[model samples]
Target: MLGHEERYDVLKRSLAREARGFTLIELAITLTVMTVLILMVVPSFTGWLNNSKVRSVAEALQNGLRAAQAEAIRRSHQTAFVLTSATPAPNTVASTSGSGSNWYIQVLPVYVGETLDPNPMVQSGSFGNLAPNVKVTASPATASLVCFNSMGRLVANSDATTSTNFGTTCTAPTGNITYDVTLTGATHPLRVLVGLGGQVRMCDTTRVLSTSAPDGCP
Candidate 1:
């Protein structure tokens, strides 16, 4: 008794209603796929954020060092990069948040840059911080002191660790970093450590990175 158009409309609506319902298995499969995607994405995002932070901080230090070196050469005067940890003594890079344990680099107040007072030309450069979970444990070489002298070279005054001139990164006490800044919460930092020798080396608190020519920066 229905007209052709009315019947066609009824059939279309019936199909639409049927299509709106999905089986439990199909729904579960879709959810599972989404869960897998989320799991894969979250960790990668986290790692990316951490690595970017570290790299940025490292590059900043390198830039500062390069600037200091260039300034020394330009003025024919020794320019130094004064170094210090953000925290005080017993300042373990581990206990403090990464946002707190970053290093500070600044021109030594002693050298004047066309200025009268020591600090007139001085400006402090800062790095954002380690992963809040990461910490730096000083060995013996980098404990009490870290400085880039006027000769545009590194100076280590830590009583604990010592460094040697092996033509590269710290090799022994003559080369080892007294303070080992390792990642605390995780297992990665132990694989690498930085020293005050101006050498950004990676090792097991023993063999350090080469501080030779490549060290013109950090």
Candidate 2:
């Protein structure tokens, strides 16, 4: 029942009311909720990232060991997988190590021509330089060097078990010898074990090995 001009004025006021934005209180509440959500998600995401990094390094180390074992069998020559420090860039591929760099893999043909080559080494693969934050460490400490002969048998370290060299008889060490390469991060660690039987496996050290069935370390 209103006139046209009054109706137009009412419509303008309604539109103006509808166009108003949120108040400071409403914005503050929304920001608080978003902040809480982000805070909750960030820690879990960080933990998952750390766990993934550690797992990747562990798998890489395990793969390096397996590759060396396979190469020893395939070439019918003694091969060694050594954990050494990373070389600097541009010379990254060079199989040299320094005392300060992170862990890296150097695969060497331990012997050739029925004698230990003066520089019996061929660069197989490298790690650690790319993953500086992750730490690759050994349990026995002396496991930094491990070798497999032409027979695919693990060469024993002199400190832990029987000692033998390339072009010499490889004696199997007594019992089930295990060298644990642990990849540690901010939250968790992954353990990769190399056995005398030429087996490489990854295990979760947080759980019991024997009692936890398939979920435990081997």
Best by lDDT: 2
lDDT of each: 0.42, 0.57
Error of 1 at 181 (Å): 5.1
Candidate 2, residue 106: lDDT: 26
Cα lDDT tens digits for candidate 2, 1-218 = 99999999999999999998899999999999999999999989878877777777677777877877887888776666656564423223323221112333223434332444344344444554435566665544445556676676788523222122222222445434343333344465667776767777887766667764554675
What is the alpha-carbon lDDT of model 2 when measured against the actual structure?
A: 0.57
Each prediction's RMSD over C-alphas, in Å, is 9.4, 5.6
Q: What digit string (tens of lDDT, one per residue) describes model 1 on residues 1-218? A: 99999999999999999888878999999999999999999887776665455445445544554665555445544333333444322212112222234443333323222332333223345544453444434444332233444554555322212111111121223543333334422222332233445444433332344564332212
Q: What clash pairs does model 2 have?
A: none
Evaluated against the true structure, the overall lDDT of model 1 is 0.42
Worst 10 residues of 2 by lDDT: 159-168
TM-score of every candidate: 0.52, 0.70
Residue 4 displacement in candidate 2 (angstroms): 5.4
